[model samples]
Target chain A: MSWSFSIGSISGIRIRIHLTFALFFIWIGAAFWNEGGMAAMANGLAYILLLFLCVVLHEFGHILTARRFGSQTLDVVLLPIGGVARMKCIPEKPGQELAVALAGPGVNLVIAAVLFILLGSQTIMQDVAQPAKNVSLLSQLAVANIALAVFNLVPAFPMDGGRALRACLSYRMDRAAATKLATRIGHILAFGFGLFGFVSGYPLLMLVALFVFMGASAENNSTQLHQLARRLRVSDAMITQFSTLPVTSRIADAVALLIHSTQHDIPIVDGVGKPIGLLTRARLLRALHDLGADGQVADVMRTDVPTVSDRAELEDALRLMDEENFPAVMVADQRGHLIGMVTLENLDQMLLLARLQPRE
Target chain B: MSWSFSIGSISGIRIRIHLTFALFFIWIGAAFWNEGGMAAMANGLAYILLLFLCVVLHEFGHILTARRFGSQTLDVVLLPIGGVARMKCIPEKPGQELAVALAGPGVNLVIAAVLFILLGSQTIMQDVAQPAKNVSLLSQLAVANIALAVFNLVPAFPMDGGRALRACLSYRMDRAAATKLATRIGHILAFGFGLFGFVSGYPLLMLVALFVFMGASAENNSTQLHQLARRLRVSDAMITQFSTLPVTSRIADAVALLIHSTQHDIPIVDGVGKPIGLLTRARLLRALHDLGADGQVADVMRTDVPTVSDRAELEDALRLMDEENFPAVMVADQRGHLIGMVTLENLDQMLLLARLQPRE
Candidate 1:
């Protein structure tokens, strides 16, 4: 996801274009030029641009609908093959998710309909159906839009059709089970696509097959994790005992603590017993390398540590830790008093226990 | 990455094969069978299988070389495009990284060389140039190996050529900076490949172009994070303030806590001052729906939770959170005494600071 750069935000959701998409455009242009000179090259470039615009609009449709259900839209990234609308979180409610999933194909359908109406009004329907060797831009775009809509509705994972299938099945079963079923169907579709592609001499179909197969597997894995997280809590996984150091403690004292104790990080607390900063072995080493071990702990302690309420859901906590790339979180009371620390070692132990225990 | 199922550990790393690879086999079998009957199909299938075996050997070369330098291999997942050997961490030393990356291509080179030498005296050598159209299995495999070696040497991120480029530049610049430079070059190369692909009528070239562009961008982003993590500490980004509840509290008490406090989860502690479990709002609501508000909180609390040590590296901690899908990590001392909690909110604040602060 981080492999792309955001071009801008629409209605609070960012829009990004993968670098590969730019290459795809360039290829189309070059191929056109080589096949039929500058005029054809320009026409092909225009068509690709128009298609990508439609792709962007289709993603926005999903983003807007997700917003309607109170879920945040993170971004829409355009890949060489298609677009992906990254939601901050999928709607837990089956209906809401279904609506959001359908919105994307809805946009494509609307585009295709509009194009059809315009072509019909101009009496160019025949020309559009059997596109000429050198067709007009408007007609080409219309045909491409229709093609996009139909292709995306092929009931494959990483496509709108697969999401629609999952959402519909989720109405009857748990999300995990629904995803598993959808993934199985996706694999079947991938195999079918690959076979069709080879027989028809269409290489693009092979790419689609690859995408669907990988996408379905990824979806299943993530769904499994969500199910696992649902069965666990924060307390059962948090670390309770940790070393604490006073803000006034000397760097020498912190160094001594590191040498004698198992702890590699020491929380620095003020006189009121409130955590003010964190003193880690790495920071201490850096300080010693520059300012010497005689320096005060306050001079080297990091003050931007993240904290969490002792009473918060483990799922939310894990999400936060992942987003922020934090190693540990300090637990505190409502009065902002530092209570304890939670870390990865504790989380792993919790997971091991959960896996070993029988499901209730 | 999700294209395959891991088989087992090899020198502490998992090995997997993409589903599309099976499709590749089936297609080869069917194509040859249709062209010239069972014997021809068997020959084609054998050739394709032999080519993939070369690919596997190439990947193993990279894995074994990395292990020699004390680097850990996480898993090797075979993609339709190629195999990806995930390392626990890339070697920081320029020499080690260069050696590990070149190992894959080196293996291919050896195979190609050996094939050419053996076939040089055989009658098959006369038709090696057009082996794809010919029915000779050994000849086709020999040609394929040569192509694989040459194609993989093209400068592209996540490829041997790109990594080699980065390693060379890293000696003079920072690793992140080297990655940025290499990625930019990769983008240019991707464009070139795309253009040539279009003009040459080779559709597979388009896929190679897309892979290069995306891979380069991913490498850049990963390098940036690695650099940032090296400079930061776990404690500097942990959360410290939180809420808690007694283990004996009722579901009604949880409801009251939710209504009166902003906290959405409560860690339940026993009389011995140890955390017994956690009760999340979602779970509490589910319990209330199933067992009524009169139910005891102990019956609804999740006892399996994730935790972290206050001293763990920030990056490692974040990876654990992602792997376990935990919302928060409880920090504890070496003796398992409750200390504090870290959450996503606090980590975000630290990230904001990191972005706002000027790099040295």
Candidate 2:
């Protein structure tokens, strides 16, 4: 996922081209070029490009639909295998998810239909069916669209059809259970594809098989983790006994406190016993190295940290922390009173416990 | 990274084989089977499998060396293109990093050397070179090892050579700047490979080109972000003031706190003024839905959350939180006294500011 590049943005959704896609085009061009001339090579290249454009549009269909369901699209990256639309969050509602999943292949279907109608009206059915050695660009594009629609319709995880199946099943069972079922179906499909590709001598089909298998497994794991996070709450995993420091404290006093206490983070509180900021060891070291022991705590305290209530959803809080790239959060009470602090270490301990616990 | 399956652990490092690697074998078998018969298919399959084994050994070389430098390897995943060893952390010391990176290609060199020596002693070089159009397994394996070593030495990120280059440069320049330099060189190599592949009609070369391009770009981005994180601290981005609830508080009290204070998590403190646990809104709702208003706050509170010292490193804190899967971490002072809480929202704000801040 990290090893990709964004080409541009279309309708606010970023479009990325995977590095391997270029190899696909190059191979296609070379394999066909020797049989004809520059025209044949160009034609093959054009067809591959057109196919990928359709793939991009298909991904966009999912992106736009997900957007409507209150989810944000991170980006759509094109790989040699296919395009992937990274949705920030999939909707919990079965209907919304189903609609989003269907939107992709639906766009491809429309493209194929339009092409079919055009070819039919022009009496070019024969040319469309058995494309000539040097096929026309329009006919090639049409055929590619049709192929795209058909291929994507195969039930496989990371494929539109598979997603649709999962969404539908989620309506009957819990999302996690539905995902598990979908993964099972995906594995079966992967085996089928692998067997078919080996028998048919189509290497691309093998790639599809691999994609489906991996995607299904990833989806299952992510869904399970999310379910666990949803069932838990922030308070269920926070550390309570911590330390604090007043803003008026001197560097010498902070140092003395650090020497006597096990805490590393010193929360700077105001005269009214309200936390105003925090002073970390890194900051203290810099201050000590630059201004010596006489410097005030307020001079090095940071005030841009996030705070949370003691009762927020654990999953939501974790997600927020991950997205914001923060290390810790401050907790408060009903009267805006500083109570305790939480950090990444406390979260890890909880996760470790959860992992060690016997499953129900 | 997330699209692979772990096979088992080897020398304390997880071994994962991507589904695509299986596809690679299937494709080789199919291509050869069509060209000849079952024997030819078996020959091709054996060659590919042996080649991948060499790839695994190459990755193990990196892993073993990295271990010596106090870096833990998370896993080694085989892809269609090659193998990837995901290390827990890269050594900052230039010498150690350089040694670890060079270890990979060193394994390939040894394999090739061993094969050459065996062939020479057995006087089977000629027979190995021509095995009636099926190709000898030993000969093919030797050639593949040599090829792997050379290809990986082409200086590209996500590759052994590129890391070696970065390590060497890091000694003289900042890590981020060295990464940028190496990435530039990698891009140049990628373009060169693409051009060569286009003219020479080699699909594999084209694939390598794409891999280099994407890998370099990713390395550049990751290094840039890491540099930023290293320069910042937790105190620079934690939130101070927040709402909470007492340990004796009732469900109705929590609901009122949620409504009036907009606080979603409340820390429950005992008579000794120590935080005993946390009462989150999700738990409160579940308690109310299951046990009614008579449920005590202590009965629904969570006791296994993470806590952070006010002076902890921001990057370390974030990493711990991510690993632990904690929603929020409590911040404490020198006396193990509860100060405040830090959550994801505060971290996001800090990142936004860091990103938007004007450079001198």
Candidate 3:
């Protein structure tokens, strides 16, 4: 996010180029200049730009298909390796995942087919043997599209082919088991590809191998986390008991309360038991440290505490809590009365349990 | 962790190899086999294995230094890129961090020095210009050590030089400001290195560039989180109010309670207000679905719920909660009475707030 800047927007999704990608352009230009001259440099850069264009189209295939399946596309980032369309939706139902997975390569296949029709097989084959020579750009691009489709279909985890495999497997097994099987298969393929890449002295192929291996493991963890989220609700993970301060209470009382109770951000209520403000631990400490302890709780407590309904999904509640600024979100019942609170520390426990006691 | 397994341990720290790394060896071996037959294959494998040994020793430098500062190392992992010594203890105090940072490269410095002495500088100089020639192993190793030392001192984020820079800067300013400045420097260096790597055709340098750029952002985020943790206590992050189900409650009552309240993991209390067990939302739902709603709360509840003191640190409580399998941890007073509960959803709010409102 820091090194990348937005280049443009496509149907509401921002297209950003990472600094590495930009610098890569400069490097490619320099390399081409040394190889031939300005004309060659221009030619090489054009080829690369058009190639990345194809990559973008491939990414759109995944993006549009995922959107159709009801997942929101946040951003479209173009990198040296490929493009990424990040979304947090969990429509991993076997059928939906299979569709989304095949979409990217499906686009590449379509491009290859269109190019073959235009170029004719004999013309494209001429450049296929030695692409670096003064060959037609269209032919190279057509071959590259074919390569992209074939490469992506190699059943590597996190790749379209791997996802397709998992989806197919999920029809007969649980998602987790399906993922485990697909990931194992990915690992084996990664090993073979890496060996071939290393021996052949092609770093990009090795990079692909690394992606497959790492992607397999990362996807494995994510799948497990999603499985955990599927069964849990917000109330299941929110605390039911805590202490609060009163408007008439002093900073001294808040400090004492902090020292004695687990409630770091104490809700300040009036005589009728309505929260007038929230005194966060950081503010309380800063207040005590900066001034005397005699300040009224009403004068120091934060008044903008957000609230969520008790029956909200754990996933939704987490999203709300993450999007809001309050240290804790007040949990309220149907009557809109504050029944409890949720904090980051509380949810961290679930993460711990998820890691330690991984469900089969 | 999923793809990696322990190879061994050093001074209680487990040494693990990621699956990618293991597969990388296979790739290298195959590549060398095709390059120049069996002898060349053996030579290639030996060089790679020894090079990674240096990487491991370099990691040990950080692990040992960190331990000296009272930090614990959970594992020493051998990655394809390098090695990672994972530890959570924060001793980001300027002087201490500088020492830990330098200790790693310092190990390489010593290795190079000792190897130079053993191989003789004049003899090592012959292989320096072309390391792939039929040269003595000792001479090549000496040069490799020098390269290791120099590369690591590049002032890249998460690298020793970058951390040393932050430590030095921290002497004059707060850590957050120092990290921000150092991270910027790392970004610039990464760009320059990436450009050079791309033009000069060295993939390893490009990898280092990626490391610096990604490391800068990650370290920046981590530093901010630490700053947040440093100012807050457990009481600050804990939730303070909610409802609990009594042992006499039935599954029907739990269903009703779950529908009405935000508390998901309901504490089952006895007549004296002591928490005898905890009824997690998942279990309650599963019970109501499998059996009839007439099942008693006491008949189907987990009795292994853990407890924490009210005045504990947020960091410590989170760690404890993560280590235990309980859906929620009971917050108790000095007299050992269950005064409150901490759930996973509760702590999620703090993480959200931290990401939203970054403090300087």
Candidate 4:
């Protein structure tokens, strides 16, 4: 997402190109320039662009399927490695996941089929073995599409086939277990790919191996976190011993509370003891430097502290804290009087404790 | 962050490598394999690895400086394009930001200086111009570090120089205004890079251009949102009218309420009129199919419905709802009795209205 610019938007989904992707073209142009001059540069550019066009189509295959199942596509980013379609959420249903996973390679298969038909299958086969300079563009494209399909089907966390494999496995077990199984398989494949790349002096295979290995582990970690989150309530984790300050308190008082208490953020309450603002350590320090320690806490405190019901789910509270980039959330009772607080540090501690607890 | 594996950690900072970065070596190996076989491949690998070593040092430069200012570095990820140090938050002070920004290129400058002394500046330049097969690894790395320094110094968002530029500007102007000015300069530079790349048949420049363009716009968008958020309150944006369901209500009853009202989520209250849970339309529909319409609303309602105080800032409440992925946040008065709700739709409407409002 960083360093990527939207080239256009289609059906509400932005199509973005990463900055480094341009390097691919430059490298190709420079490589070809010495071998065959301007014509080769033009040819290389066209080929790479066409390849990315197919890649974009392949991502669309996944996007359209996800949209059909009610998951929104946030954006499709074209990286130097390949295109990635970021869905709002992956569908939980095995059937829906299977369909979405298969859709990408299916599009590639279709493209390959059409290219083979138009260019003739025999010519495509010859082109696959021959060097790029000698091959016809149509034949080269046919082979490239087939390669894309095969490459994507290599059972990895980020690969289409990896999701398809997980979907199948989930039908028999839990989603988390399925993800673990698929990730293991992906890692094994990645190791093999890396080994082969090293032995055969092929760097491309090695790069893919690294991506697969990381993707597998990352996916497993996320799934594990999701599993832990599935069984928590706000009451189980909220910090009940945090100190609160009155809205009338001075910045000096907040500074003292910050230094004397372990709390980095203190709630500022109104006359009826309802939280009106939050005096975060960062804000207090800033106020101390700029507005002086004599400034009123009400003037320096953040009034936009998102409050959550004490009875709410811990997972929801965690999500809120994470999303708002809030240091902490005020937990209130039904009448909205602050009863507790949920800080990121405490939430993390809760997660660690939960993981350590043996489950039935 | 999503697809990177930790190689190791140093002083609590995790060093990660994206799987795709392995491709850099593979690419170099293949390019040189034709020129000089295994020897060239070995030389290429050694050169690339050394270059990345320098990149790692460059990132550490930023990480160490940030740590000095008390900003935590989440991790440093090595991408095919370059290394990215994900800090918890950018320093608010102009001086701190400037130091953090300059530190990266400062590391490269030191590396380049040391390399020049060791390899000799004349030798480094000759090695850089020579083809891969003939270049010595040490000489190549010396020149590479110099190139890295120069390339990063190009003023652009996500680039160290751009941050330094922003820090300088913010000293004289407001942060938001300074960011706007820096981003404009970044965009202009990006446009120039893109045009030059297209004319010179260099794809690498184009990619850098794309990154700069997007980073500038993204930074601008975030600043605008932060500004808008600073001006609103929860009560100013909350929905006052909403349907509620008693805990005794059945799924069928909830379905009826959902169909009759615009509310997609209804608060389920206890006998004493305190909210006990939320019956979301999606949950109700899922329950209807699985548990039958006769199921009690309490059986399917989410107990973890995040709540916010009516007096909280609208931006904070909006952030909480967005983070929790809650359709609506239950708004309660000081006694914690539900008085209203804050839906994302209403939050957006409020933001839009706020933007259109005339400044004081």
Q: Lowest summed-lDDT stretch of 10 residues in model 4 chain B? A: B351-360
Which is the leading candidate under DockQ? Answer: 3
Instruction: Give a tens-digit lDDT track for model 4, residues B1-360.
Output: 267789999889899888877665576788778778998778777777888889999999998999898887878888777898887656869999999998998898898899899878898888878876577778777767778888898878658888899899989998888888889999998999877765565555666788789978877656655566667666756666566888999876775554333356789988766777887766876777667767888888998877788788866865565445577778888887887776665554443333433331
Mark the regions of model 4 whose C-alpha exceeds 4 Å error after superposition.
A194-207, A240-306, A318-330, A340-349, B1-360
Whose lDDT is greatest here?
4
User: Which 10 consecutive residues of model 1 chain A have the lowest summed lDDT?
Assistant: A351-360
Tell me which of candidates 3 and 4 scores higher on lDDT: 4
Please identify model 2 stretches exceeding 4 Å from their true place: A1-131, A134-360, B1-49, B67-80, B86-89, B121-133, B184-226, B239-306, B315-330, B338-360
Candidate 1 clashes: the total is: 64
Better of 1 and 3 by TM-score: 3
Tens digit of per-residue lDDT, candidate 4, span A1-360: 269888998888899998877766687788789779999989988898899999999999999999899987878998777898977667889999999999998998899899888878887887878876899877777778888998898777668889999999999999988988899999998999876765565555666788789978877766665676668667766766567888889876775554333356789998887888898866876776667757898888888878889778877776666555678888889998988887766554444333433341
- Point out where model 3 deviates above 4 Å: A1-34, A45-131, A138-360, B1-75, B85-93, B130-133, B187-223, B241-308, B312-330, B339-360
lDDT value, residue B113 of candidate 4: 90
Model 1: residues with Cα > 4 Å off, grouped in runs: A1-3, A9-13, A88-90, A121-125, A128-133, A183-233, A241-306, A315-329, A334-356, B1-27, B42-360
User: Residue B353 in model 3: shift from native, Å?
Assistant: 2.7
